[model samples]
Target: MKKGGTAGTGATGRRGLLKRAAFGGVVAATGALAAPQVSRAQTVTWRFQSTWPARDIFHEYAADYVKRVNEMGGGRLRLELLPAGAVVPAFQLIDAVHAGTLDGGHGVSAYWFGRNKAFSLFGTAPPWFRDANNYLGWFHYGGGEALYNELITDILKLNVVGFQNGPMPTQPLGWFKNPIERVEQLRGLKFRTVGLATDLFNELGAAVVALPGGEIVPALERGVIDGAEFNNPSSDRALGFPDVAKVYMLQSFHQHTETFEILFNKPKFEALPAELKAILKYASESNSADMSWKLQDRYPKDLLEMTQRQGVRALTTPRPILEAQLQAWDRVVARLEGDTSSPAAGPFFKKVCDSQRDWCRRTGVFFLRNEAPSVLAFNHFFARG
Candidate 1:
């Protein structure tokens, strides 16, 4: 039994050594084969179009979003930024996205209010919510997202993605040639506004015109409109509003927080693999965060500069006018609620407003009064700075 023991042991050791060598070789081959696949998976390209001017911060957010996505995706997703007029007419962005003519676009939600008055609720309102955090909370956690996506995917049948432009701050009521001291001043006053606000403005006996970003300046120049509201102070000044109009009034009560969107063609979005869809969603949310921070810092500073540099006079909105406007808005909500076609919109609107109001009453009052040190610390720093 012992005769061949040493010889058999040597043979078994040799076979074991060969098996180890084979496994090592197979692992090396697998590593080599997988390397290129991993590299190839790191590349993707997309295009984003916007109606905003290339120089506007609103558009700047779009550019930043591309960079953030590319970085966060570790070079897997690449988005190319296209200024207004690159893919389609700036005004036709919503249509382009819906038709799959373009990948996606940057546009204000109010622009599509023509599709339904209920759509305007996402943007802003007269005598409604003002704080940016409240607005963000409404969209993300207040059932607004569910209602919004359903409105697009279920009702309009488009694959639309949206994000916050954040609150544009207390916007100037508008550029006006005369003081609107009396309610009578509103009658026959031509204003530029979109959505259900137009109906409310009409009810107040004022004429409202819907115009695109490019058209507003020309219309103001030509006296097509007596007053206009485009955006915040910096944006308005950039558009040369000061040169054309005399009075820069305070607080866009009608637009406390206007939400904007970047809509994608539903079919195109759905066709993507799950990972790519995720990349898009993360990109949008990241964009919202970045934009909110920037605007919060930039808006108040810009307004201060306007007052100091341009000699812009800030007119206060009369309290009575604001109260009456709120009353009228209540009627607008009630009338829309009675119409069954927008049943979802009615409850959704009420819920957001109620939530926002509750937050305002509980926390907002102290913040505005500055009774609590932590209250509105961010707003105070920015406004005072």
Candidate 2:
């Protein structure tokens, strides 16, 4: 009986040991399955800079883009935002990103037009489109993207990839100390602007000063410039333009439509995991749509404040001045497209210009036809009587 009891006790001990071993194997299997997830949780961080001041709405747009990218990345990718002059000046962002000093940057393509005239074709073209939306459609649906890549990568050979963000509204003619009652008034008026507009204004006989946004107010205060156009009403107000200049011209053909260029280092962008790269590109589209909506809401309010509270006089730019600008644009376009000064200039500029022109011809006709009734209805409904 004692021997049988000892044998039973040994049998029970063996069964318990086998059960614990089986549980251990299950735990090991679970841990093996979880190991890859732990590895994927590792984070990747990048530094970004913008050609906008810290308090500018453009900076807000940049920050909004960063926030969206981070949330979508699920903690795997992080982008840090720095305002203008953080690492380099506003116009040098493209070169800085190309050299890898910044992982990415936010600016307009026209800022680097000196590199190639084709940059203006993408940045801020003369008033070819009806509005910013029309230009954006050409960029996305038209062949603009391929030509843009050709200009940036193949021709210029910059090691960077760019996405177009925010489609800006028509920039004002500018703020002037005295009202411009005639096209001739523009002659010899020292003006501050950038991009192709500088050339256009110069053709119109203004002494164009290519000053950055931050310097415009100071230049105006110091009598260095007689008039200037920076961006929107809010930005112009914040930059203190209202204090120095009382006449705000409400329309212009100079930069009827433009968009922000968000650039990434080609190597860094290529090295990113496929999903992360998609996030970077798609975020621009999302942010651009959001920005347009915000602008629609904000610009009107700011314009009201500028006129009513700031003791500023707002006037529709005279018809002759508008007509004169269109004529100036004709000359500028002809010069850019006909110049064989740079081997890449004429053909590359024509490629982009042709694409935009073709799109404008077809799409613009449709817009003009469809928009006429809307304008009529709007006028009838909002008649000032």
Top model number, lDDT: 2
Model 2, residue pairs in steric clash: none
The TM-score between candidate 1 and the true structure equals: 0.80
Query: How does model 2 score by TM-score?
Result: 0.92
| Model 1: lDDT of residue 201 | 74
Give the alpha carbon lDDT tens digit for every residue of 1-385 in model 2. 7899889988988998898899889999989998768756777788999998887778888998999898898778899999999999998899999999999988888888778877887859878887777888888898788888988888889999999879899999999998999988889999998888988999999999987677889999999999999989878877788899999999888989989999999999999999999999999999999999998888899889999999999999988899999998998888888887776468678778888999989998888887657777888889759
Worst 10 residues of 2 by lDDT: 342-351
lDDT per residue as tens, model 1, 176-271 = 887787777888999997767777777778899988666777798899999888878767776777777768878545666676677777777777
Please give the CA lDDT of all the candidate structures.
Answer: 0.72, 0.88
Off by over 4 Å in 1: 1-42, 340-385
Top TM-score: which candidate number? 2
Residue 10, candidate 2: how far off, in angstroms?
11
